[model samples]
Target chain A: MENQVTRVVFYVSDGTAITAEAIGHAVLSQYPVSLTQHILPFVETVERAREIRTRIDEIYARSGRRPLVFYSIVAAEVREQIVASQGFCQDILAALVSPLQEELGVPPQSTLRRTHGLTKHNFERYDARIAAIDYTLAHDDGMSLRQLDQAEAILLGVSRCGKTPTSLYLAMQFGIRAVNYPFIADDMDVLALPPGLRPHHDKLFGLTIDPERLAVIREERRSGSLYASLRQCRLEITEVEALYRRHGIPHLNTTNHSVEEISTKVIEMLGLERRMF
Target chain B: MENQVTRVVFYVSDGTAITAEAIGHAVLSQYPVSLTQHILPFVETVERAREIRTRIDEIYARSGRRPLVFYSIVAAEVREQIVASQGFCQDILAALVSPLQEELGVPPQSTLRRTHGLTKHNFERYDARIAAIDYTLAHDDGMSLRQLDQAEAILLGVSRCGKTPTSLYLAMQFGIRAVNYPFIADDMDVLALPPGLRPHHDKLFGLTIDPERLAVIREERRSGSLYASLRQCRLEITEVEALYRRHGIPHLNTTNHSVEEISTKVIEMLGLERRMF
Candidate 1:
């Protein structure tokens, strides 16, 4: 920790500050500097802004280096306080907004716009997202097969192979109704698509993982059990991969991917319309 | 849609394109223009990049205006194809990265860095996230109070008051072990903290909603029923709010907030350390 150059960075916003944090992380990832990060969200009031400004200034005084502040604040008074601090303040949204405003020839709306807030304009979409989540929860782990028609995608995988998280991400992030079913040890003897899932084959997506990784994940849940054995994991994966290939089901190896990547790839492979929340 | 200035915007990337789309949406929200938006993810191949470039060029030729393109690609060859198109291209991360490079006195690494990818460096953190999700799912809706010691926060709310989604978001986005318990009509007669939850009073947070909104949301699930009645909603909310006040539990009205906003506020209110995934 003492070896590299450490920089203090803050992501500040009047709203959730998710956008600022995301952009800041992406920008910082490019450089080799280590970061001591803080996120200050919902900085709407002037008092809070002044406190944050003081914090930024104090960090500068203590470190003898200017802190980097990436912020998206709508109010001028609050934003000015952060700008007045002894830090390099970068407006996360302003750089792109100015060009877009010029292109559209429309003055930017000065109203406090909540990028991640619920408004009347997006209430329906928001409701749909909730519905997707509900549908997903009800159908998780093959809980129900009655509503297969409503599912945008059905994920098939062994336990802990990234099906549940990917399904939930698809529903939560993109408002897509996702169903995930697990292929347990009992199914290894006769590895075939369940009769109930046969009709929805087009929506089926498989997730397989490296046996070594799967064994490690399972061992965490049930330590020193046969279920967590490497031999079992390898056997299950071999059978599952053979089943997928025989059925011509498009699948992904989830050994090295995150839930975000798996969900995005699932949506792309299935040609599902990506709904932005 | 025709009355307003309509612009075609593309968020192109070699990865999930989530960051690009997020930044693009935040920037474009300030303007009053209608958008025909497209997200092109995983444009890793030159062939795919060329196709996207042709698509952007065709849109420009048809509209007689340069389409707006916000992209983040690590590959020079693929990025050049998008840049060569007749669109107002904006490098989403480059604008900030260049300045940070000068600040840190470190040259940026030219390797392909996947912002949302799982790697050995983050595998333990990633495992913790999955464990959080598993804990949350097991403890959702008062499924079990056996592991209250492991919970970072316990959400208390009336039915349909936005506890479940908020809890899931906290677990998924911040890797917080959140447990949500719903107050049902059966418990309204003697409204008090459950015996199991009394030990974790410090971890308890309340979520309330407007009666009208609760009724509307409930009606979507069960139309023309007592469960969806406005009177029932009002009674439940009144009792829940009184209970929250009696217990000195901090609460928020989730009537006008999105899941993201509510989750962020919960973490802020509880002073929980925000973990970035």
Candidate 2:
């Protein structure tokens, strides 16, 4: 039982459960616990809630410990049923909605799935996101230096050092037009900004990571290659950081950071305004 | 003044300010107030905090109304300065940290920017996300059908029907391997799933949208093409919905939904398990 120490956790929501999962992940990460997650998304009906409660109770009975549930269900009856469950429940939306309603002086519409729905005014934001995604995909890996002028930021990084995912994350999350340019071996040795990136130098932000981390990431892609060697990673990273300093282009090490962290930090460092909601 | 009604809003943080912006966005969306935002990120020093306080006070003096500030500063002294300002403050991180500490029975690590950092356990999730992103990019728009066996979900939709962005969002946010296949004009007319998608029928989820909305979206991309015409959009949507029913495939209309909503709906409809945190 000690070796099989797994706490059953559920992220239950009437809608997508994304909000529940986001807040739950943030909160749960602060604690050092081994969790097994059961995401019961779209738990809109009383029957669904009842079924989820039963599953949670079963887990609790087996483990001899209360299950942890983070929920964002909006329907009153459905919420009540979950409340009656044996598991310890954290009501994510309910906890915020009252304070928000009081602050805003307007009752919520309480419409199902309203949080992630697009309003008339926000359609432009959607369009901007789509545009950013397209821009990011097209301009990925120095694909089109001609459109460097259109990019809000050009990410320069050694291969496998967290550029592509961060670019796509920035594009999708904040509608920031991000383009990533990989620093290849030839480019790294010279320690010069790529000829294509020179005119748009202000938009350049470098991403580097610990060489050991880079080696691990690259080895997963292509094992036994010199490209995945720690020495190669160290040389590339050192040169790229030097290149960034020489060009006065600010940079961050992506060693311990997630894509979300990298994207937000990049935005902060560059003083880039989010193009849309 | 009625037409010029605007509230000054600030998202203040010692790190990226993403959490402040996220909670603030959710809270402020419930109100009808039009906001002019001033994001102050990486406000670490007391001097910077005082400067921000002065700025907030100046905004209050000009508008004759207190500005709204959503802050996630972890440091006590810096948070105090923001609290001392004229702005009406909502302490987002403070609201959660205390509750979380009490619930988890441990004081917070209080480390700046730890919320989005990577842990050793989560590195596998990061690898999964990179794999997903690569898989998505390769299989985008029916580009490759050889690996349909590998996809967690296959999106079927008409052209310009919110497939690409939704796929990218799922991959980045949830590490879900999503591949989107666009239904071409010929395929829509035939009212059939593309041959490439036939083998993966169980994995298919359809995206449809209002014809007028589709027309508006398409018009932005290709102004005078037949594909952008309202008649063409209506024809494609009607046929696609019919095709979804004929195959008993679940579908969602993305007309009023954001990418987040669509991705979640798709995941729910298919009962897809998120591959990572």
Query: lDDT of all the models against the reference?
Result: 0.92, 0.80
lDDT of 2 by residue, B11-124 (tens): 898766665676676666655667899877778888999999999999889878788888877688988999999988877645444565554455666555355657786788
Where does the lowest 10-residue lDDT sum fall in candidate 1 chain A? A94-103
RMSD of every candidate to native, in Å, equals: 1.1, 3.5
Off by over 4 Å in 2: A1-10, A32-34, A43-69, A73-90, A93-113, A189-191, B1-6, B41-51, B57-64, B73-78, B84-86, B93-113, B186-196
Model 2 per-residue lDDT tens digits across residues A157-262: 9888888899998898888899999989877646677677888888889998999999998898899999999999999988988888888999998887778778
**RMSD, candidate 2, Å:** 3.5
> In candidate 1, which residue ranges exceed 4 Å CA deviation?
none
Interface RMSD of each: 1.0, 3.2
